[model samples]
Every structure is written in structure tokens, then in C-alpha cells.
Target: MNYDQLMFNINAYKENNQILDLAKFLVYEFELDHPNLEGFGFRDELEKNSILLTANGDIGERQMVLIPRNLFDFEFNLVINMIAHEMLHVRQKSPEMMLEDKNEREWQAYYEMLFHTNFPNVPDVSDYHKKFFAEKALEYYRRMGEGSELQAKYADQKLKVLSLIDNIQHNQA
Candidate 1:
């Protein structure tokens, strides 16, 4: 996919949907010039049964976003979010820069993902996405084995997130 056009379309969609800081975060992740310097594209073949949304090559060689041929089949929010999620992977500087533990890495990444998606107004993260992300957070926490520090910390965080979601869902009644 053409990075500019794809990002443009996603930006337009994001603007209409909600104000997200993801665009700003994207610029911050790169030095401005280096991000759009290489080729970015979609995958050639995908089975209808597959669950893959995106993939990429080394950040050095090129970054590929493998989207299903029927990209338009999904909702615009989900599609844009999926692309933003893939972009996060590309933004990682190096394998060595990654966190030592797999669970923590995903937890942090997803937290950042929810941050960008839910809270765009710097210093203010709305509950607009709390419900959606809380569910995801719960899933991630569940994946970690019992008695893990990561699990305990995230369990508390999930309760707070879910409580916020409940308050919002109940209209604070």
C-alpha cells in the first residue's frame, strides 16, 4: 500500500471518528523523514479462514502491512486501528530494544495502543475506549500464568479500567 495514501485515508477516518493522538505518536516514533522513506504494501494471498490482520519485514529492509484483499469488509474504525497496531510493531527500534518478557511487551504495547486510541487530548484519557480495551486487557492478563507480578499488576489495572467503563456505561446512575 502507498504509505501516504493509506495514512491519509486512515487519518481522515480517524478525524471523523474521534480525536486520537496516534498521528502525533506516529511522528514521535520516527524522525519525520525516515518513516515514509521506504516501501509499505499489502499481502498477495490470504485464506478466507485466516485471522491475520497485518505483518511486516525488518524495520531496516522494508515494512510491509499485509492486509486482506477485502480490506473494506471491516468497519473503518477496526481497519484503521488494525493498521495503527501494525505501525506500532514497525516503530520498535530493534529486537534488543524490546522488553525481556513477552507478556510485558504486549501489555505495554496494548496499553500504549489504548492510550492513543482512547486519549488524544494529552494528559486526558477518556473512557471512550475503556470498555473495548478493558476487555482486551483482561484477555492479556489472563494469558499470563497465575502468581506472576505482571498478572497481579494488570489485574488491578483491569479492575480500574472496567470500573471506569461501568460508570460510563451506566451513565453514572
Candidate 2:
């Protein structure tokens, strides 16, 4: 999609009091297909810095993306990227799955958040943010070295994350 067109459309949604529509549009545009993908809306109680998509841990519950009520405080692009990050979490769940490694989940989510083409604008991923991601990447790397089949399977992603970390560390701004 064209960056200018996307931004203009998002702004229109923002002005029309249809931010939830914007979120739904993003979910569809991102092609986040899941039977449990309920819908998107705001939550007053959600913390300011977080946009979360939650899966129902119990039966009969549903999955939904909860945006902060103070949505106007965040940049539209960043907010979309954050929602995409949470939706990535939504896509990771299963009906009866084992607890997955937190580092692995986070690294994968972060990779998609920063690199996905559906998001035309990438907000500044701060040095602090990179450090946090680097720790997760290193832990995943450690798991790979220890012969974790699951981690080993993501070796290509591991290398990419480490390469990004290396590039950023050496070329500090």
C-alpha cells in the first residue's frame, strides 16, 4: 500500500471517531487469520505504554486487541505497529499448546513489528529497545547453541536478529 494513502486514510478514521475501524482494517490488511480473532476496541484500564491482544486462557472466552483509551497520545504509525505486534501474539496461540519460550515469542514479535511491509512507517526503535531485544535475541541464541530443536529451527531468524543487534551496537548514534 502507498504510505501517503495509508496515512491519509488512518487520519480520516481518527477524525471520524472510527479508530476501531482502523484497527479492524489493519487486522484484515495484515491477514491475521485466526478463528479466535474477535475484534478491536479501546480499554480505559489498559496501561498507557501498552497495546495488548489477549487470548482467552479459559474455554468459552474470546481473543481481542485492547487499545489504550488515550490513543490520541500515540503516533498513528507507532500505534498500528504496536497493535500488529500484539496481533502477532494472537497468531502464536493454539487450543492446547505448551508454554513457549518468552524470549522466542518476543523476538519473533519484535522482528515482525519492525520489519513487516504492511507497516509502511517504522517508528524509532530506541537504543533501550534494541538492548531489550538484544537480550531476548541472545537468550534465543543460547537456546540454539544448547541444541534446542525449537530454537534451532529458527536459526535463520536468530542470525538476522543478531546481525541487527551487531549493526546497531557498532554503529551507535
Among these predicted structures, which one has the highest lDDT? 2
Candidate 1 per-residue lDDT over residues 1-173, each given as its tens digit: 45677567656745664233443333333322135223344465466543244435553444455555555444444445555555555554234343345555455555654555332422223455446655666676777877788787677666666676687789846
Each candidate's lDDT (Cα)? 0.51, 0.63
How far off is residue 2 in model 1, in Å? 21
How close is every model to the real structure, measured as TM-score?
0.52, 0.66
State the lDDT at 150 in candidate 2: 65
Candidate 2 per-residue lDDT, tens place, 41-100, comes to: 666646767544443333333467677655655766556566766666666554443236
In model 1, the runs with Cα more than 4 Å from the true position are 1-39, 44-52, 57-63, 117-130, 152-156
Off by over 4 Å in 2: 45-62, 95-103, 117-149
